[model samples]
Target: MNPLIQGLATIILGVGGCIGYFYASNLLLDKVLYPAKGPNIASNIRRANIIRPWLFIFPALLVLTVYLAYPVVGSAYRSLFNRSGDEFIALGNYVALLESPEFRRSFLNNALWAIFVPVMSVTAGLIAAQLSDTLKWGNIAKSLIFMPMAISFVGASLIWKFVYAVDSDIGLINAVLAGLFGAGPIDVIQIPFWNNFFLMFILVWIQTGFAMVILSAALRGIPEETIEAAILDGANPFQIFFRIKMPQIFSTIVVVWTTITVASLKIFDIVYAMTGGNFGTEILPSYMMSFMFRDDGRATSVALVIMIIVLPVMISNIRQAQKELR
Candidate 1:
């Protein structure tokens, strides 16, 4: 079958299958199990209503089990083995990971990312949101700022590679430096401890727009009465923004912070694309990929560690979102 035709057929079959299932289930409830024609019609309707919700929820439950639950469980089980999965060495992979210097470096880089990316992105976003709202061409400015978000992480990393290239002729920063001061070309991504920050800036550049859009809506949602009262009380612009505005939208800030924190924790593409986990830029996901051909046990063990770290931050984001809804 042609690929496009196959896709269309799959869509049609999926829709048709869902319609058929619902129709058949309801028909069975009405005609066979709970007939409306009987003396117990009211009780039968009530019973059918109770079962109907579960029927609707069953598909979603199955998908969650297959996609989400199964992967976590499978990874956990796979981690309790030798490199080739021949013999059982429960928790040995994890113990090795704890002691490995490379793993420690990756963990430290990830920790720095978790702390630095969210904070910088949100701060830059807040500044952009505040400053842009006052300009006539603010939407245009926002569009340009957000343009990076549309680029894939690998594409963005590749683009930035040119800017950070070792050649002064090709790299933007080196060209400026060589033009002005006759300085030598520097590989920005190769500086050991500080190179982490240079890579993190890529994520920040991509995520800043996301943070801006969310925080912009939150800023717009702030009650005008409070701003008016603050102004009447002779609060400075800084005071109103920090004391009044920030307090009002602190929860939204936290939600944005946690959302970016989750992204930073799972960061892989930029590091992998730019440095291939070399020069001390190996975050957890990139580090995990380093074991792809060597061992399943070590790879899965690293993945489980990532899941454990992300779970709490994800739950906190969910809870904060729920609080927003309330």
Candidate 2:
């Protein structure tokens, strides 16, 4: 059979099966569980009662267990075994990961990213949001500032790659530096700790727009009467921002911070595209991918490491969501 035809057949069958199952289930429920009375029914015949809403939730719970919960448990099991999936290696992979200098470096780089990217991105976004809020052409300023978010991470990295290209005439950064300092073109990605900073700048650039959009909406949500009251009480602009507006949107600030933190934790595309995790710029995700082909155990260990690193922020975000629900 043709591969395309087989693929189409599979999709059609899957859709038909789902539709048929839903239709049959509804028919069965209506006929057997919730049947209507007819004119010939006995007067003393008891009607069936509907089950509680929680009983109706069982199918969704089962689906989640099969799709989400099972996979997580299976991955955790796989992380314990070696590449062959036969021999149990216990914590050997994790131990090697911790003891290896390269892994350590990746951990430190990821740690730096987690710390700096969120803080800098949210800070820049907050400042931009505040400034744009007070400006007459706020929408125009916001549209320009938020334009970078429209670019994918890979595209942004490619764009910045040009900015950091080695040629003094072509790369904007080197061009500006060469004109000023009369120095030769330098490779930005090869510059040790500074390269991490360069890679982080891309994330900050992309995420600042995200932070701005969220924080700006939060800023606009602040009541006008509160700001006027603060002004009447002799509060200056700084005081109004810090004392009045900041308090009102503190939860939103936390949400933006955690959101950016989670994104920075899983950041792989920018670093991968820009440097391929070279020159001491390897974060956890990129470093993990390097081990994938050579050693599956080590790669899975690194995957678990990323999961551990991200778990806290995920929990915090969940808690924030719960609080918001209340």
Candidate 3:
């Protein structure tokens, strides 16, 4: 059979099956319960009628169990073993990770990311959003600021790679520094500790737009009446921003902080593209990938570490979303 024809047949069958199931289930329910409605009903019959829909839900639940829940459990189990997939090493992978210097540096880098990226990005975004809000050309400013977010992390890394290029003429940073300070071209990625900061700046550049858009929306949601009242009370511009606007959007601040924090935790592309996790720039995800050919134990440990690091922030975000929904 032709692939397109097969695909169309499969889709039609799926639609037909779903329609048949609904039609049959409704018919069964009507015959068994709906036609027998009475002034008084037994509790068991009422319960059974209520639970009839659950029969239809069972297939979806099973699918989720297989696809989502099982894989998580299976991955956790696989992490307990070594690369051979035979020996049960228990927490040996984790123990090795804790003692490894490379893993330690990766952990430290991730911690820096969780702290620095969110703070810097959110701060830059907040400042940009505030400034843009007041400007007549605010839309143009926002478009330019947001342009970076449209670029892939790898693409952004390549763009910055030229900016930090080693040759004075080839790299923008080197050219500017050479002209202004009479200094030689610098290989920014090769610099220790600080190179991580440089790599993180790319992420900050990309994520700042996301932070700004969310924050700008929140800023717009602020009531005109509140600002007027603050003005009537003789509040200065700084006072209105700090005392009134900031407080109203405090929850949004938390949301943006955690959102960036989560992205930072899983960051891989910029570091991988610019440095290949070299020069002490490895974070958890890239470090985990390094073990793909060699030590499965260490790699799994890194994966678990990433999971553990992200779990708390994920939970907090969930709770915040729930609160917002309420």
Candidate 4:
């Protein structure tokens, strides 16, 4: 009954059971239920072809329903109930959330993040992608620029936290500023409103790499002849990029924008690790966590709000993907 052993055993059993069930079920369907050697061999083969894809897809559909669909519904339901879940409060939680100053601040900060992070990240990424391509050691430059994408949000926050640390000696930014200006250390995170941008800079740094890699690929995929024609027509580098190249890569830019928009809405770790959602840096996810145990209905309401905010971006991304597929 050791917890570690029990967990390992459960994992093994779960994986083994799924493999066994799928293999056995497929075997049963082919061998016992519809033997290909029998008189109706052609019919059996056709039926198997029709059912095989569904067999593979069914497990994924079930997992999506269980993991994704369930939680959304559960959150919605919880938001309608009281803290103890014994009493129904209807739209009271949402009304309270909209009315709460803290929630309003979180909402505004989140909105600012959604706007600032994506735009700045995409802009920085596009510039890096375009510039790196023209370099002789472009691949090396791209690799260096893309490096931060490998770091987790919390890890990046820790790294930037040192840069923003109150101590002038240890923190890189304050130390340099102090040395230059002969001033004391600055507690950047304690500064209201502006501190949110400081946290946003971390995300922009991390996501710029993502945007760069994607946009870089999109940039490279552009036809060389088009750029050659642009140059032949007396187009400068800026003209070639803005007028000729950018139009082609616009879709990818939108993709990167919406993708990062969704991410900024769900940002938690950086703010949590850096400021613990204090000093005007609180966002929706962090606010939800703060209220989770103290007030279940309000916590769920905040979660639902976050979901609502991200849902449209998700839908747009999905639609764009499908359009591209078509």
Candidate 5:
């Protein structure tokens, strides 16, 4: 039961089981089912050649079915039931979610997150990318900007919590305000309507660095000859970037945008850490947590809703990436 021994045992069992399964399955296929040495050897071998790839993939398929696929299907199924899950109440949880004021508020907040975070993060990142590329010490500047991405979302939120603290001496924002204008200490997160944005800033601050890193690479990959030609044609700096480079790397931008959008849609950590979904900052994931244990149906229904919203963006991202490859 020792933690280290348990981990080692898990590793050994996992690896050993995989090896044993593959070996045993192959043996069964070759010796029993296919029997490549038998009277129907040629046909059996051909059949096995066709089936061999699936054999290799079967374990992976099983894992996916057990983990990802089952959970999705099960959540959808369970969402049909009532709070206790003892009675069948088809579409009941979804209806209740639609009726609930908190659910509506959470949905709106999630929408705000999905829209605001990706747009601001990607735009800021693109600008940072361009500026960093233009500046002499751009790499150093990028490193400083990107430092936030290295911090976990919870950590970043806690850091920002101090900045937004109510105490003038303890909080940086209040300290500066007290210095310049002698403004009173403010509990920023307690502010209604706007507090959602205040919470969102933590995520944006964390994700902006990720966007910058991605967009910087994309910018660098733009052909230099195109920029040179644009300059020869009397295009300004802004025109050269928007007209020339933007078109070239739009796919990468979409990839980054969708990636961030999906993260924002399912974001829980920053809200959970800082606000705990209080003060109108309740996103879907955090909203779902409010119903945890007490109302399994509604919690899962919220999860399903998050998935429904995110699935399309994910699919679009995939298709756009595929188009870029083509």
Candidate 6:
């Protein structure tokens, strides 16, 4: 029962079982149910071809139903109930949730975060992409900037927590401010309303790198002819960017925007690690986590709210993907 052995066993069994099932099922269908050697071979082959795709997809569909669909449906169902889930109090949790000042604050903060994070991240990313494209050491510069994307949210939060620490000697920001401007040690994350922005800065910092990497690739993918054509028209750098490059990469920008938007909606780790959802920095995900064990119904309600917010972005992404696929 060693952990590593257990893991290896699980992996072997899972993969081996999947391979065995598919092989056995296909063999049974082709050889046993409708043999290709017998009469009506052409029709049997056509039938098998039609059914084979479903057979291949069946396992994946089942996995999605269990892992993705069930949780969402179950959470929606749970959101209508009371604390212990014995009493069916339809919409009561939502009503109480909406009426509460804390939840409202969290909702407002989330809205602000959703707005700021995506826009700023995308803007910063675009700027980085453009600037890096002109430099000889651009890849090195980009590697440094995009490095934060590899850092975990919790790790980034911890790093920023030290930077924003209240102790002037310990916190770099406080130390710099106090040394230069003689400013007092500022508890940045303790201030209400504005504290939300402070917390959001961490996410923006982390997400900017992700945004940069994606936007950079999109920028690189832009044709050289378009820029040359713009140059021929006496277009300035700003004009070239806004008029030509921006239009070309608009869909990519939307993809980055919606991606960060979804991440912001589901943001939890940074806020949880840094502020613990304190000082009015409670976002939907963190707020939901706060009530997770204490109030199942209410927690599920918050989760549903987060899901509702993300639904549009998810749909938009899906449509964009499908359009691209077509």
Strongest candidate by lDDT: 1
Model 1 lDDT tens row, 1-326: 89999999999999999888878988898789988778998999899889988878787889999999899999999999989999999899999999999999999999999999999999999999998888999999888888898999999998899999989888998999999999988889988799999999999999999999889889999999999999999999999999999999998898899889999988799999989999988999999999977999999999999999988986876786799799
**lDDT value for model 3:** 0.87
CA RMSD of each candidate after superposition:
2.1, 3.6, 3.8, 1.9, 2.2, 1.6
Q: What is the alpha-carbon lDDT for the whole of candidate 5? A: 0.91
| Top-TM-score candidate index | 6
Ranking by TM-score: 6, 4, 1, 5, 2, 3
In terms of lDDT, which candidate is stronger, 1 or 2?
Answer: 1
Evaluated against the true structure, the overall lDDT of model 1 is 0.92
Runs with alpha carbons beyond 4 Å of true place in candidate 3: 1-68, 321-326
Choose 4 or 5, whichever is better by TM-score: 4
Predicted structure 4: lDDT: 0.91
Worst 10 residues of 2 by lDDT: 40-49
Candidate 5 lDDT tens digits, 242-266: 8999999998898899899989987
lDDT of 3 at 313: 82
- lDDT of all predictions: 0.92, 0.86, 0.87, 0.91, 0.91, 0.91
Q: Which regions in candidate 2 have their CA more than 4 angstroms from the true location?
A: 1-21, 38-67, 323-326
List model 2 lDDT by residue over 229-262, tens digit each: 9899999999998899999999899888988888
**Candidate 5, residue 75: lDDT:** 94
lDDT of 6 by residue, 35-78 (tens): 78778999999898889999899999999999999999999999
Candidate 6 CA-lDDT value = 0.91
The sequence of per-residue lDDT tens digits that candidate 3 reaches over residues 1-326 is 99999999999998998888877876776566553456544664576578677867966888899987786677688889987879999988888888889889989989999999999999999999999999999989999999998999999999999899999878989999999999887898998899999999999999999999999999999999999999999999999999999999898998899889989988788888999988889999899988876877667677777888888986877887799799
Provide TM-scores for the models: 0.93, 0.87, 0.83, 0.94, 0.92, 0.95
